[model samples]
Every structure is written in structure tokens, then in C-alpha cells.
Target: MGASRLLVSGIACLIDFDDAALSGPPASAVPTVRSGVDLLIEDGRIVEVGAGLPAGTAEVIDASDRVVLPGFVDTHRHLWLTALRALTTETDLGGYLESVAGRLGPRFTPDDLRASAYFGALECLDAGVTTVQDYAHAMRSPDHADAAVSALEASGIRAVFGYGFPVFSTARDLVDIRRVRERYFPADDGSLLTMALSPMGPSYSPIESVREDWKLARELALPIAVHVGAGPVAQRPIATLEREGLLTAGTVYVHANSLPDEELRLIASSGGSVAIAPAVEAQMGHGAPMIGRLRAAGIGYGLGVDVVTATAGDMFTLMRAALVTGYLGAGSRPSPADVLRAATLGGAEVLGLAGRIGSLRAGKRADLVLLRADAPNLLPLHHDPVGTVVSSAHPGNVDTVIVDGRVVKRDGALVAGSLPAAREALLAAAHRIAG
Candidate 1:
């Protein structure tokens, strides 16, 4: 769908906010839905959004019974682990580490990695998630890393390919990151596909090892993502990291459910972001969800579909889990609009992409999703549209998916690739790797 001009006409509800609200000026009022609006997309960007927009010489999409929203952003995911889906459903955090990491990780070949990455990315896009942060921790070799990156590039999804270094890895294994950076992402200037470093955090490795990885990330000037606060050590590791002055704004701490408020404040002041995986954390016995503490500390937090092994990968499930767990923890319900923000703009801020793809502003790349409002589950929408989306809508209701103004899914089906072929590839890879 390159070089196509598409006009989405008569949109029932256009949900977005002003880009100026992101500049940290005096906050404007919350964004509201504009009914009966039309959006004109040309050259892979939204050119106009208002009433009476002409659709001259442009392909038109009928959105009279759909709610158009900026595509959901997933801050953290292990896209290479799609072949292991549902195998770890009954396993908790410890079992996962021992089984998935220790046993299965060492067996994956480069071909397996590529197929899994492709299938995982397609699943995410089908669920209306346009952007993702793929924490690929199974990079067993330089070839494996290259294969994973190539698969993501081929999937046509916007992603941050996090080059993973496990605690058991040697320094020589990580030497290829520089080459990978230079080969794939030579231009460090705001490309849609960027590079990140997934270092083994202090919780899983020694302080010296953590220092080594963090130093490499700083030298490359790339973002760092690490797992923290899932075990019983509490905030001791974070306190030590703070004392050593290793924390920076590029750090993205995951699973901070057990952390105290003081540490959350420290992360915010240090300009770091947090990724809370409610479903995985709850299923795996990580402490109570920290939505209340995170909000009180004023930290920029976003939801993540941590692992497909334990939970669903769709943002709808993530949004619903965040809403329910957050309500239970805070003792006060969060608005549906607020939940949607966490899924979209909040995730963008975590990935440092607030100026680009979070909302449906005029100049932003047209990454959007159209949900069928006439579905039985979404019928009888009398009150808040956002509320119905958060509490009721599922992935099956996704009728159209657009990323960078290209139609990826039309009429509720993917525009490219056969689902059966993708599924067969995943199963074959899993059998070969897990055998």
C-alpha cells in the first residue's frame, strides 16, 4: 500500500489529543472524541482530520460504524519466544527462568529464531498493536541476533530490537552489538526501527557484570531495558545501582511491582521509565501491582505484554488487566481514557517516541486501528466509547489495521502472508528447538 492516498470518511469517533500537550507546558485539558470527523492520509502521514474533507482521487475507507484510535504501543515483549507460547502457562517466574532460559534457549537455531520473530510480530499486528519493544534475550550467537533483526524488518512492524545479553553470557558474545548497530541502524537519528541494549540487570547478575553492560549501552548512546523487582531482594539492588550512579534516563526498568515508593521516586527523578506487566506479574507471584505507587511518584509508566508464554499478547488483554489490577490496587477506578493513554502515549514516552507515533496528530505517521462498533460484544454502546473499548472490545473486533499509512489488515484479515503457513512454521521451529 505504498504511495496510496486513503481517506477515512465519516468516522464515528476520532480519538486523539494535541501534540502540544507532550511538551510539558501547562497541561491542556484532556483530549475528547470528535464524532463525524474525517481523516485524510497521504504519503504515509495524516494530512488532515476534520469535517468536510474532500476525498478527491483517493481510496476511501468507510468508518461510519468504527472507532479510530492511535495504534497501541507495547513497551516490552520477547518476540522471539513465540514458538514457546502456552508451554509455560503453568510455570511461574522461577520455573520460567529454569525451563525457558536454561533449557530451551540454548537449543534455538538461527532459523528457529527468524520464524518465531516473524510469527510473533504478525500476531501482535493482527491484534492492532502497531509498535513494540522486542526484548530478544535468546540471542545465542551473532547469526541468531542477525536473524531476529531481519525477521522483525520483514514483518513490517515498527519495533525496537533489543539486543539481549544474558547473565551467563561472556563479554565476547556481546562484542557483535557494535557491528549489529553499525550494520542495521547506522543512522541514530530517530529512525522508525531503532536499537536498544537488553542487559542482564543486577537482580540476575553481579554488579560488575551489570556495570559492564551498562557501560556498553552508554558508549552506544542507546536505551537500556532490564528486569527488576521480581524477586525477594526488594530495592537493595536498585539502591546499590543508585549509589554507584549507574542509572540514567535511557534505562527502562521492568516489573517494578515489589518496589517501594522511594525507589519509584528515584527512578522518576533520574528520568528512567517503568514497564508494569500486570498479567504476568500477577500470575507469577510478583508482589502487588504498583499502579498506586507509580502514579503517586509521578513516574512515567506503561503496560507491557511481558511474555506470550504466560499471557496473551494482545493489547486489549493488557489494557483490561491494567484496568482491573489498577482499580483493585488503587481502591479507585481509573478512567477508560486514562487506561487508553497508558497503552498509547504512555508507552510512546517510555520508548522516547512521544513526538512521533503515539497519537493521531496531523503530522504524525498514520499508525492507527479501526474497531468494529457493530460487533455483538461491542453493541449497545450508549455511554463512553473508550469505556466499551477498554472493558468489552476484543481482538476479533479489529476490522482494519494501519501502520505508517499502509493497510496491513483490511476487512478483519491480514493483507499479506497465510496464517496456516505462519502457524506451521512456528510449530516446526518449536519442535526442532524443544526436542
Candidate 2:
């Protein structure tokens, strides 16, 4: 463990509120934003937050001219596809499937997977995203899974490695999933890494296959993440899952864009959550993002960068997309505070890690981001700090990022891991695979 650190003189958004806060009318919730606040962190957890705390042998980080908040949580991401960025920007879902899944996926080696995962994780950290649920769907072999997990461990970012079923395979077995669990994540030890099962849901798989996949997830006692309402399928996914007795809690439904209100209600009643990738959904023709519907259904939802291959992998872009799409598509205009909560605490709830890493409470893990409030684009530091973050902030405004009591990006540059080496390796792999 390192020395204790104190963050002083910053505007802080605690996001510490009950579920009823979101269910009630807008701005009806208790105020969580504060000014001239300080946070004390030690042993990888927040120790306290108040007006003025004594700095007892701690390193004092001046947070003046900054807006400090809980670091962003990305609920869904295909991190292994980072090297293939912009390859499918002009394509729809089918074209993405053809180019990424059919063409480039098969060409990846374990080294390539490691390079992509490490670089992708670092990119998220640089953008002040402290946590991510990496949907590792490109796992062609057990070696591939191991490579991705090791890269995440080395990157120092909090992550849930969603061990995915092998894509484009007829067998679609869970043999390697069990192996990975026993090897990398034997228990819920307090490490930054955890495991989840990413299986093709009822929409993309046969009932038998879905049954087997769900069985394996239960056997491992892991949470599930699956794609729903992503493309044309034979059956209504949520209804079919309910009918089959497989709609379980702690499951995150990704991209429920085309699902009806009743289906979203099913998710909420069943204690499930949704992960919306607004940028990818709008660009790839999945459907209008289901932000308004999700809010009306009272379902907890989080934003995601589904694939860097199609959109910018930053929460700033994602938040703005969610806001504009919420207005244009469903006539539900979410305030900047609402979107910020979704990006942070709401995302933590979706991943079932709320108790551990969501807010800036005294007991939670110390995952924090400090944005430059004095930046030219964010000047004036208006009365609504969260509004500035949601509307004007970008990755370039990320002045510092700390995850689990470790400073990863400080002074607007990444300080953890070997970024230069990771970049070279990723470029080399991209050349070999995409060429």
C-alpha cells in the first residue's frame, strides 16, 4: 500500500442517493453536488469527504480549478476489437459482422489479443474511465481468454472480464469458460479483476444452446451479460427468456433498442438492467437508443462504447449522444445530472459492483476523476458542475485519474504501464490482421 492522499478544494459530485431519487421527479432527489470539498483516501478506499480535513502525512493533491467525481464506469465494451478502430465506421451491423467477426477475428493471435486489451484498457484510463466490463467475444481459444485477462491485470484498471462464447463456432461449448474461472478468478477476492459470462442470448442462439450457456453461468456462480434487440431474430428475446425460465437477476441486457416498453418492464421486474451504447446504436442502425423508454420503465441503465471500431471510445461522446438521442427519439430529455449518474453509479449498479466501486462515499473504493474546470471549453465553471461535464467535457479535459487508490493518469498524461510499447505492439498486430 502507498501513502494516503488528500484531494482538496474541488467541486465534487458524490452521486450518493437512494433508488427512489431517480424514480421521483427530476431535481427532486437530494443534492449531491458540493463545492470546496475534500476527499481523503487510504488503503484503496475512501476514508472521508468533507469541507476541510487535516492532511496527516498524506500527499496533498490540489484540486483547485477542477471538478472531482467518481470515475466513469463503462458497462459494456468489446475491448479486444480496439485495434480495428474505424474499420467499420461506414457499415451497418451486418457489415460489422462481416468485416470484424468474419474477416479480422479469425486472424488474431494470443499476442494480438494481449496488445489490444492492454492498449484499449489504457485508452479507457486516459479518458477517465476507471472501470469497464470487457465483453471478450473474440475468444477463439483458451489462450485468447488468458491473454485478455492478463492484459487487463497489467493495465491497472478495474474490469470484469466477460468470458465470451467463441463466435462463429457451431459447437459453442463452455469448457474453456470453466477453465478460465478456475485459473484466473477462483474466488471473489478483492482484486480489481472479476469474471462474468458473456453468452449469445436467446436472440442469437437456439433454446438448447441458451439453456446450456445459462447452466454454465449458474454453475460458475457468475453474472451474465448478453446482447438483446441487436438485430433480426426469430423470437422476442425477453419474453422468450422469461418463458424458458432463464431471465435471471444480475444480468445486463446490452442494446435493447428495439424492445418494447413491456419487455423493458420485464427486465425491471426481474431485477435486470440495460446497457445502452448510444453512439454505436445511432451509427450502426441498431435502432433509436432506448434511453427514454429505459427511464420510463424505471430500469437502471448505463452507457457503453460497444465497439471502438464504430465510434469514439470515450464517455464524453457517449453522454452527449445519449442526451441528444433521448430528446430526438423519445421526447425524454435527461438532465446532465441524470446522464452523469448513469455513467457512474448507475453503471456500477448494472455490473453488480455498486457496493464496492460506484460513489465517493467513505467506504467505497477510491476511483476518481479530476476534470480541468478552467479549460477553455469549460470556462466559467458554471453553477451546475455536472452540466458542464455532460455538455462540454472531453477526454482532453481529463487532468487526473485515480483508480483503487492508484494514480493511473496524472497531469493529463497516462503514468501507468508502458504505453509506448503497447502502442507499437497494437499497430503491429493491426497491420498483420487487417492487412
TM-score of each: 0.94, 0.95
Tens digits of per-residue lDDT for model 1, 140-219: 78999899998888788888899986435554465798989889988766555899998777777777777888888888
Off by over 4 Å in 2: 1-31
Compose the digit string of candidate 2's lDDT tens values, residues 1-435.
Answer: 334665544454333434434332233223377677778988778889888888787777888678787889999999999999899999999899988988789899999999999999999999999999999997888889889999999999999999885566655647889899999999998789999999888888788888889988999999999999834553489988899898898899999888877888899899899999999999998887687778777788888999999999999999999888877777466777778888888888889888887688888888988888789987766666667788998999999899998889889999989999999999999999997
Error at 352, model 2, angstroms: 0.5
Candidate of highest TM-score: 2
In candidate 2, list every pair of residues with a backbone clash. Answer: none
- List CA RMSD, all candidates: 2.2, 2.1
Best of the candidates, lDDT: 2
Instruction: Score candidate 2 by TM-score against the native.
Output: 0.95
